[model samples]
Target: MSASPHPLHELDPAPAPSVLALVPAPAPVPAVPVVPANRAPRANTPLMRKEHRDNIALFRYQVIRGAADPSLSTRQRGPLVRALALVDHPWPYGGTRRFSRESLDRWIKAWHRDGFDGLKPDERATAPGTDPSILLLAESLKREKPNRTTAQVKRIITETLGQAPSETTLLRHFRAKNISTGARPVATGRFETVASNEIWVGDALHGPRIGGRKTYLFAFLDDHSRMVTTARWAWAEDAIRLSAVLRPALETHGIPEVLYLDNGAAMSDKSLARTCAKLGIKLVHSAPYRPQGRGKIERFFNTVTSQFLGEITVTDTPMLPGTAPEAGSQIGSLEELNTLFTAWVNMVYHHQQHSSTGQTPLTRWEASWEHRTPVRKPLETIRQAFLWSDTRKVSKTGTVSLHSNSYEVDPLLAGTSIELVYDPFDLDGEITVNNNQGIPAGTAKPVDIGRHVHTKVINAVKDNDTATNINTGINYLDLVATRHRQSLSGAPISFADLHDHTTPKNQTQPAVSEEEQP
Candidate 1:
């Protein structure tokens, strides 16, 4: 029976009906016409009505792209944002426009979290609450007086129009128009002097830490030549360090007619005022928080930061000419830093052609001197000008106390308030006694000396001279220092050599032996 079944099944296979015919063929899809790469898709073509918003988004993206780079570190981002904020961009709607720093920062942050879509302005459900006319009025009021407050502008608008927008609304409008209370004018022209040494702008830059102590740069720039007249890095920003830098500058480059400075404690000290008055140099301080006339000095500082400070580090070996220190070199001392800076200023900065003046700073300076001589003062006069003064009433014993040190004055000056003028660095030395009318009465000899220098001078010495063993070979500043010493070799008054050799003006002094001439 199994054999018969197998034979029947094999015979019933009658040419297995074509199974392939039973399956249906897929219907042909209409060929999708490929759009060219440059052509927009038909379904998503941009409309003219949306072009303005698109342009605005594009503009914002352009402004923020540099600051929004994902790979940028925080330090890089900040400078890019600031640089972008300072640039004027061609506006899509019309004239040029400059974004505020805050606005630029906000846009960059928005772009970082979201893509290009984030830069587009959000669609408003309704028009802004402020009227166009009201905004125009607020802008006009701000232009008329930049110091006007938003509240004042709002009050005036309410008085004139009998109704006004909120102060916040007015403030926003003012900001949009770049006429906010804090905003500077767009077209303010640059200020420059007619000739070199006419004006010297001075400023202090907080610099890198050396030997675990912060450093400060005291610098002065010539307004006409853009020359760095004097620059020094010190550990302290005090009147003493300022004098140390400024005195040399006066001696080397001659006196400036006007010394423009900021209102810092170091710059505003009475000593600086007295020095200026004695030199016949007008001391002008910039308005508080207003750095209008200091652009040249600031630009020079930027150059120093980029060209000089950027290339240098703490190093033991002298840097090669036209070469930077090896990577990871440590700055050994402040003296080395000063030496390196002096070389850079003399070799690189002085040689480069300044963009504003179209001439090298050194060239411009020398050219100015060809036509005019800089005003200069005698060394004695300068020394007397920089002397520190204090007023004290003489006791019954004919003594006056200054900085915890006692000095004996003429007996006639007893019980009288007199001005004691002396070198701050040498409080142990003799002091000149001036009567109330500023007439020299007599010299005050040190009776009981404790501190040899003023408290500020002590602090400066501790901070600045922390590491004095550094040896830098053959630098421009050292040569200048040598020349300075040589020039003063014949002068009897030496700051480095404090001796009690001053004799009374009325008394005749014995002539010194040839062997004791020094």
Candidate 2:
């Protein structure tokens, strides 16, 4: 049975030649050549020289602008052409020989069809020979008195050649003559102060709505230190709100020499100017539409928007727990918003290194602060100095009218003119009435004249209006020693001296009093 195997079914017959290996390899593929439609613009390839190129560019810009200008009327072509021809046109390459009427028409048509690039000559393998006349014209144009426009140029060419030249053609010849048409480079200005607190920039920011009402943040930034002196949130962008913010900053950081402000509602108010005048603060407003001077405050606002508002504002996704959970009560209370903002400012912002200062704002401020002497004033003094004042006579009811509200005043001041020092937005509606002697008579609280029509007594003054000042300077004790010394001499004494004294010496007193001596 083993010998009966068929030979056609050989167990180890050689495999048929592999078809893939046997087949001849296809011819190597040829890469598709990439042909550029246009050559790159070369610096030296243009017909016009460097200066002439800019002139041509300026010409082109002028024509393009004129073409689109609704001011030029096409109806008076004759008069228009006549008027335009009188203008002294500048041509860089040479005299405006190429600027002919027919030329202008053709170029303008081409421009209409294909925009700016259309005015350029068709591709030429070799640079066309430069025209000396055209070159001369371009130079003259650049130097031409009272720079000329395309139409005026076209008219001039017409007058000289008896046929108007093509504005488009002339512009094309000088296309790269100059880039005078390009926007002027923005001039960078330095607005920083040399020393910290020398200058402060203030501006108001429109913040997220609270309780369906818009909120504004008034902030002051020290230009040199890049430190925000104070920031207050308010419902209105009024002078009163601004004063509230500015006073605190003045108290804490001392007064800035110059207060750079914008011509906005908060800074432009008359009260703000008056306040600055009183404090010897030079209030400077940036030129209208110019924000270069307010860069510091603007930058601060940018930081606030990105860092603080981004995290806490109700508009953001990651708002505080109670922030705008509902539309009725915006963002937790303003107190909460203020609390969070203050913490960030004191704990985070003041400690961070400022990009401009290369030191933490507070640190940089302190560095200058070492050598600088800020006239630190008490908050009450600042308030008193910053108050808005106007003279008004007290009424028969011992009252005065302010902002349409009547205030009850001292009966002694009845029918007397008094200078009222007050916060315009006095929460308690109280006015500090000062008599002619500059004495604080009393607080005039808002009263309903109708409510007190028949009342004989007026209790407008607060019981605490006793006006107690702990005489920090020149106290009785200071003069007591002088008095005792004078008693021994039996003459008058003036010990507590307080005039022109930048620094006062500590006075000494005898251990035992005169009366206690045996």
Best by lDDT: 1
Candidate 2 lDDT over 1-518, as tens digits, reads: 23332221222233344422332443443322222425423445545334334444445434333332223333322232333334554343333322433344454455667665566555444554545565455445433422334433443344334554365655555554652322222223366778977888888999886545566788887888777777766666776556656755675578888998889876887778878887888989989987787666777776666445644424323447775332111233454445456555665567667766689887877788686587766555566666677689888978887655678888898888898776543424456788977798878777743342111111211111121222122311222223333323111111111011222222122010111100
Instruction: Evaluate model 2: give its lDDT.
Output: 0.53
Error of 2 at 228 (Å): 1.0
Per-residue lDDT tens digits for candidate 1, residues 368-479, read 8886788877766777888878889999999889999988999998898999888887887768999888899989998888999888777655553444454445422343
Candidate 1's error at 235, in angstroms? 0.8
Model 1 residue 302 lDDT? 68
Q: For residue 271, what is the lDDT in candidate 1?
A: 88
Model 2 quality (TM-score) = 0.43
- For all predicted structures, in order, the TM-scores are 0.54, 0.43
